[model samples]
Target: MSDSDLYATHTVENQPQVLLPYNLWSADRMLVHAVQQNHSDLPTSTLTDFGNIAGDQLMNAGELANKNKPHFQPFDRYGRRIDNVEFHPAYHELMGEAMTAQVHAYSWKNESTTGSHVIRAALLFMHSQADAGTTCPLTMTHAGVAALRNAPDLPRYWADKVISGEYDPRSIPASQKRGITLGMGMTEKQGGSDVRRNTTRADIQADGSYRITGHKFFFSAPMCDAHLILAQSTKGLSCFLLPRILEDGSLNHVRIQRLKDKLGDWSNASSEVEFQGATAHLVGEEGRGVPVIIDMVSLTRLDCMIGSTSLMRQALVQALHHTQHREAFGAKLIEQPLMKNVLADLTLEVAASLALTMRVARAVDLAKANQHEAHLSRIATAIGKYWICKRTPAFVNEAQECLGGIGYVEENILPRLYRQAPLNSIWEGSANVQCLDVLRALRKEPEAINALFVELQKAVGKNSAYDKHIENLKAAFDEQETLEIRSRLLVEQMALALQGALLLNADDKDMAEAFCLARLGKQQGLVFGTLPASVPFDEIIQRGKLEN
Candidate 1:
């Protein structure tokens, strides 16, 4: 079957189905374009080179996945894209590279609005393909690995151009570039988090393909191009790489009858997908799908952590800018001692979140480079995802406090960021679920924790503030005698300290120190059953000044 025929047939067959409102899609596209333009910067030739490679691959894959763009009319009941879909780095190759540069550029002028738009565009494209049943070739499993490895071939076609450090972002037209979108069809409505109980059946067809029949309730990015779907194949509970489009690049049997009215990420279309014998291809071996999918989930969860941290960083930046500029009671808001403390605390939190995110990213990179133990990669990925995902929302909320009334306003980005922040923790895996996984890994491989501790000890040896935090963490670990209690507390404290250290190590050393000290003080108060009677507030203040 030709790709065009397949698309036409699928569209005709699904014509009766409700089409996504076009205005919504247009509004979203407009917002993305505006943001991208607002944030445009001189491309980092080096990063652009890397991006070109990935971009070329995506372009080829997208072309091969020939699908129609579904209209997205951005409007609420009252006709508005109030909850605009913020762009991300994950989708656009150029934008992703741009984000990497932004992190390292250290030039305020390098900050551009385009990165977010590229992400949003990719997400929208995914949604459109999901609605159309076009196969998503940009499998999250391989994509995650590619991202971490910074493999030029992984992003494929544009590899040499991107890696050559001479690619131009402007040369790539927005219309030609595919947008970023994700697929979520993992939850078994009956079994909840237990994939083993998933009864969704996939029977091998005569043509070597499988027909999947079942219902998935909590599917996110259901309308995306590719979905890492879970099902019961012949081997056991497994994952399948199901695309909205078929191999010929046409809509498959997937159907999206309803759109979710989400609490956040509203612009990103999410829906409950019903597969009435949807066509699918088995990923890896049959029974290995679940583990493979879990691996993908771990990496995604890590990305979610970075995303959350990014949100917090953006929120903090906005809040600080507001406070510094906005005056009340005849003084700038930041000048107030209480506000100062709030800003200080927020700064610490944001810094910590950034450090933790970088640490996880590096760990992911290291694991990819070594290619030694899948188990180790899995554990490290889980740890990174769980720790940062849990902390990002908290940081955002605290930062929001700095914005005061403005934070609550819909127009102010904080409220949107705050609402979106919580989704990361819930998605990939919940906090409790991740904690249990951590405990399981620790119990199964005690050496993972020990190895991590050894690394932490090395970090503590440094004279930086993170070293002090590690020292305090070690003190706490040593103080506990009970195996069970100590293990639990140690995990919690270590997660915090490790994240602090990672953040410090990756992005900003000075900010990391400030954050580590702040965390140490907060933790000391909680763990020791009393706040320091006389916190060396002056010392902390002095340290903060020196760091800043």
Candidate 2:
């Protein structure tokens, strides 16, 4: 009963320790298995090393970066229009680590390698868990390569810097930098996702360069050296590469209006900008902006799936960690039947998500060489993006609920995760947009539907529940005229079937069966933790938990 006793009226008894310095790769059994299944020559050490950093040091860096948000510096001390966004040192550190790890450059760098997309996807999954904000530039830089290929000269001029695996944060001409990052400026105030309605105009000058005159309502990652933007040319809307600095080392005419105080992603800076006759280089054929940029959009959509999945994984891990240590009603929370049901249900979700995401990554890798794979990648990206992003917010909310009141506090990472959970679903395209894209794919590319069925057929006889689910999906397509109205439901069923098929073929038979039962067999309730009582909760929890 001394001074310390008086201050501590009660000890902090049941609170679990903060989750840090854990191995993200080693602890994620499903991700590890998915990698082994997808890649023939796995970069084991590289992934293991990245997992360690992402789990510990990178997590701390993310906290610091978010706590100290980026500042917009529109003018210099002399009132010169510098138009730069200054970031915390931690954000730069995260960017450097991401670049050095080759998350942005991996697939393109190893284009000929087998399963390159799978490897890169795995890396992105881990990176996003640590800091989702920095992933914006990383994703854009990686996806920009796809758009750059359409312009022959643009690739030679910018490809080297984009794939340099070095992050140059200096706001200077691209030529002077050791490396560079790319950004996008598409949506306008008038047109949110409808790029065709954009008011931006691009006029050809005496030189080959074009002068772009318009404003972008959402100019993401404003500090990027260059952006692939769309503007109206004489022909029609066209894609252009607009740089922040001109070739002669003078700042371009791009004017940064102000930054968007967003709901989340505090570490990244998203700004509204106006290009006042800014010099730009046309990317592809005039009036074909949407077709040309679709390649970049596809890659970014895949990243959306990966990012959301990462958020779910981290949230589930946090929940498991909490329940394992915390106690109530004279027993550990993990041992409680209801909580175990919730935890096990979440475990199955993460496993199925990893399986489906990795499977799509493999499809992307093989797309160039195989026609079926190409079609599958086209359709599956939309489905995965739609479903995974849609599920993340609720998944994170459930995880937050596991920790009760403490989880809502700012001091914990759960609050940040909860805020970030909905961003991926809204970023690339909202749920409705994704569903429409899937319908468009079905109408335009018949081969895409065939490819999807071919993939689902791989596990046809593995489980009766999965087989029945596939049959139901096939039957739903007969009502083609109603697809647009019921697009969300159609896409969701397609997604669940894909996940069920992947899990059925995976190594863990029991886990696969449980997924089929709960997700497909109608043995579960509407929300998570509704798995049938027969499911082995203890084994599933053990499989998913991080060892303390």
Best by TM-score: 2
lDDT of 1 by residue, 1-548 (tens): 88888777443321112211222122222222222332344233533343333233433332222222223333458864322222222233323332333221112121133233233222322232211112121223223332222223223322222222121222122122233223558786687777788888899999767899987876654444446678988788776756565545445666665566666654344566678888876665677666666556655665565566556545555566666567778787767666665556555554454444444444444453443333444565566566666666776777677667767876445666676777767776776667667767767877666656655664564435566667666576444345444454555676776656454444344545545555654633322112232333333223222111
Residue 288 of model 1, lDDT score: 63
Candidate 1 has its poorest 10 consecutive residues by lDDT at: 129-138
Model 1 stretches astray by more than 4 angstroms:
1-43, 46-182, 247-250, 371-377, 462-490, 500-513, 521-548
- Per-residue lDDT for 478-526 in model 2, tens only? 9988989999999999999999988888778888999999889999998
Cα RMSD of all models vs. native, in order, equals: 15.4, 1.2
Backbone clashes for every candidate come to: 40, 0
In candidate 2, which residue ranges exceed 4 Å CA deviation?
Answer: 6-8
